[model samples]
Target chain A: MDTLTTPQVINSEYLLKHWQGHRNLTRKVIDAFPENHFFEFTIGGMRTAAQLTAEILAMGAPALKSIVDRSEEPFSENRFNLETKAEYLTKWDESTAAINANWEELSAQDFHETFNLFGLYNFPVIQNIQYFIDNEIHHRGQMFVYLRALGITPPFFWER
Target chain B: MDTLTTPQVINSEYLLKHWQGHRNLTRKVIDAFPENHFFEFTIGGMRTAAQLTAEILAMGAPALKSIVDRSEEPFSENRFNLETKAEYLTKWDESTAAINANWEELSAQDFHETFNLFGLYNFPVIQNIQYFIDNEIHHRGQMFVYLRALGITPPFFWER
Candidate 1:
């Protein structure tokens, strides 16, 4: 993808490509997480590792859908009420693929239109796509610290 | 703080209380993100630092709204498209206050109801809250790395 385009220049293809990149990166990070630590690490009363994974999996689709539909609710407001890690992961994968599948459903014009995203404010669809990507990156940064606090070399950031 | 309670047992107050903890922690980490870095860091093919903050600020209120409405779209699907550090931080502060103000709107039974969260699937509102906190933790994990990569010492995790 051309690296010089502004966020407003991004389209469904850019979003799908970036989404896949994020999913791939997330998988790489998850692979490096020690199973024991997965349920046990805490930094100042924060969540356990298992809980973090569940959180990532949980928001994958809702956030993407919100960006796509330009809906006015937080992504977490709608949840599966999941009972298992497997379920959350399944949804995560499905959401990744959904971004690819639904890319075409979003018109180029949609990218230019501004959305309210819950009466919070309005941004172009393209900026929203960039936000989705940036969001994943921010979380990955935290996971690396989790690994380091546990003394692990997280997979290279570029491997994803 | 009862670790024994299943996520379902935790209501919005529990979630909000927990999230407040996350905010405190993240605030410390955010402090380490140098004013210059706040809008400028990049690793491999990733978003600029300012964009990351915007995503975080954008998600806060919308995510809560989604939980409250049990809606399928992201609360940010269209509300914001910030480009400056000042804009993002302003929004972030607004979101933080919004969370504190409206947290009481949630009832314990609200935790039991399933939410669609962008049609990704259904998860209890309670679990979704957990996800939100964990999500913040995950992203904060990324911020920690950003700080470290920049050769900065992050505050004590507990300091949050």
Candidate 2:
């Protein structure tokens, strides 16, 4: 694998598009949950979908902003205070916009630079960004099971 | 985003490493499962952990092999007939090796080529490969919930 000869597989734009595609599917997952179940449902003592969403919400734009600002803020999921599913959807939209805005501030070289994500998880900037998408997918997977358990089918995983 | 100007963020080697990291974490998830629960535990009418593992086992190497052969075999999860946790572990190792072997056969240009995955998903070969990782993480998330339900702590997601 000669780095100089190998063609690049994806660019930052492609990476953002791919991440957003997962976000779109995840928003659908959020929409599919019954309002009550969104906050109250649980399986085997796992966190409710709301709690999981909060963790995801806490990470994305904040992490990106941290990278852009070179700020090492401690990670916290309690930043958002919301009492309803509608509130979560609103916050999700805001975070989506924030991610795009923050993304533009990053140079291609920034991806190779190390950033301590949420003041922890020291890694290359790209890996941290990938982790955001991976984490969302992971949580959304749990929501899929939650939906199924509630007798609802999740949006097709491949549709994204 | 100018396609010509943007630097590529990843190559085939990086993609493989990122994916194998998830596989490593997921393999640990499997190892953490109690044998009986691996085969039979359920929450809210979901498939057991073993069933989910079977679906993952069915996809990874088989999909890569399909791309390498240009053979659009219909997707099937019943290919492996393992009945125990240890058997699944053995098969997982085999599939991991198979993935590495098939990966070597794919060129940088192949990532941009379109292949009908499992004769189902008609997308770029890269997206299909990505689905393999996404699907594994999704199932692993469910297993995480299952582990919690069983009073077990899953491996840290970031450790991957």
Candidate 3:
């Protein structure tokens, strides 16, 4: 009897679904901000809302590109320094759509292959997707602190 | 030459903070979840809130055990199957405290060293923290979707 259990596998479909879920949750959080407040607002001397939005926008394209090309240059934050929230949002939407478009292209076999992401060596495809969504939520967690600090109530986590 | 930027090092700290921060965040998210829903209300066949919580609780002790012993068992999930959420939460809280305590024990030298987690291979301490927090957020993302689908609002992302 083969008592060894198979490892749980996550398909691209699952990754894309989770990706959109983060985007939708984030959109609601972003909407909670006043127009002017969106660009400013910080807690614990961390990145401002606009800056964090830029960070979120920056993750998708660069990450997908990094995974696809197997580049390991530590995805540059300088590449994401944006001037406007609209630009960030637009970029975020585009990135989200791009991931959804290209996700299916990621084969099940690719899940196990190692790729370099930001000079980080030998990361598998699943780890890459894990990193992508985790990055967003980490910043989103920061935004949550900022939102409450600013006396704003973000959408309930389930509202999305 | 010591050319690495301050923000780069700070980014590492940021990543570490994120690991601890979300551990704290999980405590709050768990509070908001009514007990009944703990094992119910999964989105798209994702892990249940209870299962997700089990997964989070598993991160430290088992992984650390594996690392310390250099074992390849990946910490059996069967060990996690227990009677009540309270039992799991107690373990989770204990695990969280253990991580903080152990985190202090590590010096600058220990970060880059490999430590076996999940029987795969040991990652650097910094990378391990990233994996720690990122894994929590992944399941939390699933919880967020479940909350929405069940018409329950998860707490604002940053009540902690």
Q: What share of the true interface contacts does each candidate keep?
A: 0.18, 0.64, 0.04
Candidate 2's residue-wise lDDT over A81-144, tens digit each? 8789999999999988998998999877788788887778899898889888999999999999
Backbone clash tally (model 2): 0
The number of clashing residue pairs in each candidate reads: 36, 0, 6
lDDT of 1 by residue, A42-89 (tens): 554556556666666655656556767766775453366544445545
- Cα TM-score per model: 0.48, 0.94, 0.51
The candidate that achieves the highest lDDT relative to the unseen native structure: 2
- Residue pairs that clash (backbone atoms under 3 angstroms), model 3: A72-A118, A72-A119, A73-A119, A74-A118, A74-A119, B115-B122
lDDT (0 to 1) per candidate: 0.61, 0.88, 0.61
Candidate order, DockQ descending: 2, 1, 3
- TM-score, candidate 3, chain B alone: 0.78
Show model 1 residue runs off by greater than 4 Å.
A1-160, B1-11, B75-78
**Model 2: lDDT to the true structure:** 0.88
Ranking by lDDT: 2, 3, 1
TM-score of chain A of each: 0.74, 0.95, 0.84
Tens-place lDDT digits, model 2, residues B47-82:
899999999999998889999999999988889899
Question: TM-score of the B chain in model 1?
Answer: 0.79
DockQ of the candidate models in sequence = 0.08, 0.58, 0.05
lDDT of 3 by residue, A1-160 (tens): 1111122222245346656876888877877777777886654344677777776766676777667666675856658566666666676777767777666566556665777667764655655665567768766755665566567766665344
Q: Residue B120 in model 3: shift from native, Å?
A: 36
Model 2 per-residue lDDT at A2: 47
Off by over 4 Å in 2: A1-5, B1-6
Candidate number that wins on TM-score, 1 or 3: 3
